[model samples]
Target: MIAGRVRGVLRPLSVVSIAIVLVLLIYGLLGYSVTAVVDGVLAGSVTSPSAAEQTLRWTVPLLLMGLGIAVAFKAGYFNVGAQGQMYVGAMASLVVGLWGDGRAPVLVIPLAFVAAVLAGAVWSLAAGLLRLLLGADEVVTSLMLNFVAVLLLQWSTSGPLKSRAGTGQAATSESIDAGYRISTSTGVSVPIFVICAAAVAVTAILVNWTRTGLEISLVGRNPVMARWQGINSTGVGLVVFGFSGGCAGLAGAVEAFGPAGSLRAGFSPQVGFMAVVVALVGGLGALGVLLAALFFGALRAASLYLPVVTNLPQSGIDLLSGVIALLITATGIPLLRRRRRRRRAPTAGGTSEVADRPVARRREVVAR
Candidate 1:
């Protein structure tokens, strides 16, 4: 157990180290000094108060979304529709905010939050139900839904919620009412921090100490065994997807009400995908996700700040993130396959327990 904990800590650290080295080497070959690059990264990410604030700003959404994705992952569903779910959530919040203009913030804000969560949960459940009822692949369906969501955002910003102001370059909704906004320009606030902290605490408890959490783990580890144990895998999948999408949606609402203050077309473009990396790198634990979100958030801050402070292109920082994602995925596959194989292997007596079971009971379990 001690060794496992140590390995867990080392895995994320190694990914970070390797990514940093690769970025440095690549940029060095491009003629930038290593010291300059390092200095710029630190200055842009955490050295200054403004940079630290920016890092936290990005961390909020990433952490919330990561937590949700981690749950889906643990339940054996690869629900990658967070981008679309987030868009839908933002659109829902925007509609509510627009309709509630001039109303008391206490009233409008809660309504907006509920609207966002429900919209997101429904969007995710659409994919989950398809998988459960029609045998559709959740990964493919969820990913396709992301494009649909982007289009929806585009139409809403261009047609329904389109701002009447003069700026024509970017399609965007009118700014949310000032009273309903969550934060100022900095995008970090006491309320926002409290919300994120509460999410982390709740998710941690739900995943680590609950009966549903055990079912989710069992389902992910071995669905057939889970079924034999009388767990409802389908119901678990629905719960996982709903929770995941709701988290993503809440993040979108936070973004819309906090720093964004309006829905912009293609807002937070690749954050959804990056959040998958955050979930995996953080080992899918609440505390781990928190730390990983901050790390990625710092990288995000540095990426934008690099172009301003040094000759390094923003892509350099992006490349580092990509490398880390690649490493995590590549390393995870073998371990997963190995576990599956070990679970199926025969006992020391050279007898296969599953094989020896009655054929009727050994049949491939189908979803209810």
Candidate 2:
């Protein structure tokens, strides 16, 4: 019995393990030196002091956004509006920071953060509301919102928030006050790390410990069953959407305060989408999300360093990431089909046994 159970557990894991290895082998055969690429990624991510800092800088936003994506996935919502939500959050924070007029850092910074979070929540809630009320498809709405948010950022930085003495191809708002800035250009700071840690901790607790978390999970797994069980699935959907948006917004605020330090058009353009990849690779669990974020963060940090150290272009890294995402998604199909077949096979055998046994029992009773 123990051996049977062990085999059952190992079967799924072995399949996944083999799939990952196959992906690596394919990449290796594509004229990419796996060893060299791995070494370069590690060197760029954490071998040196500056490299480690860059890794942390990249990890923070990815982690935050991954957590957000996990929340939406848990609640059965596909909120692809994270990119747009992040842009709105950054824009909101920039407006607050610029207009605060030298207010106390304690006062202004917190306010800006709150504004960022609220902006993200409102932006996401629009999609959720549409999904609930108008029965609109969220994927389309969220994807379109991303472009709208990008344009909004361009407008804000180029028009009202344009730097007074700027001369460059890229438009940017004025630099934030030094005192208000969270970190230097290097992007690692004590305060920002603390905020990210707190966000992750609180989110994890909410998902694991709270009643709402249980309800949301139920809703995701089966909305009809959740409603039958007396859970308010609609409320759960709204909460998840708001929470996801808030997390993305917080990431945007961190970028504005720590690394970017000003509103810039197209800043962190596809990072939000990349966070979805991180969440999926991490297995959509909090701990998985954290680890996956670190891995992707390392990739982002390494991408910058690769050009300096190797002959490869940044496009190579992009292509590699895209390949990983595609493979992971494609592998899900066979795994799911196998699981479904396994489940049905047992049910079919049990039904046949029940049919044959009842007839045999009746014959034995009549013969006796």
Error of 2 at 283 (Å): 2.2
Model 1 pairs in collision:
none
Q: Write candidate 1's Cα lDDT for 1-368 as tens digits.
A: 79987897789788878878887898889898889878888998999659999899889889989999988877767788999999999999989999999999999998998899889999999988877666567779999999999999998999889999938888999888999999987789998998899889988998889999999888778866886799876788889999999999999999889999999899999899999889888877899999999999999988889888788888978888898999987875555444344232234443344545665464645321
Instruction: State in Å the error of residue 355, model 1.
Output: 12
Off by over 4 Å in 2: 1-32, 331-368
Tens-digit lDDT track of model 2 for 1-368: 68954664454344445654664576578776777766777788989559998998999999998899888876767787899999999889988888786789999899999999999999998887777555566778888888999999999889989998789677898877888999998888899889978887888888889999898777776665566689875688789989999989989999898888898899888799888777666655687788778877888998888777666667767765676666655753344334222221112122323225567999999999
TM-score of each: 0.91, 0.84
RMSD score of candidate 1 (Å): 5.6
Off by over 4 Å in 1: 333-368
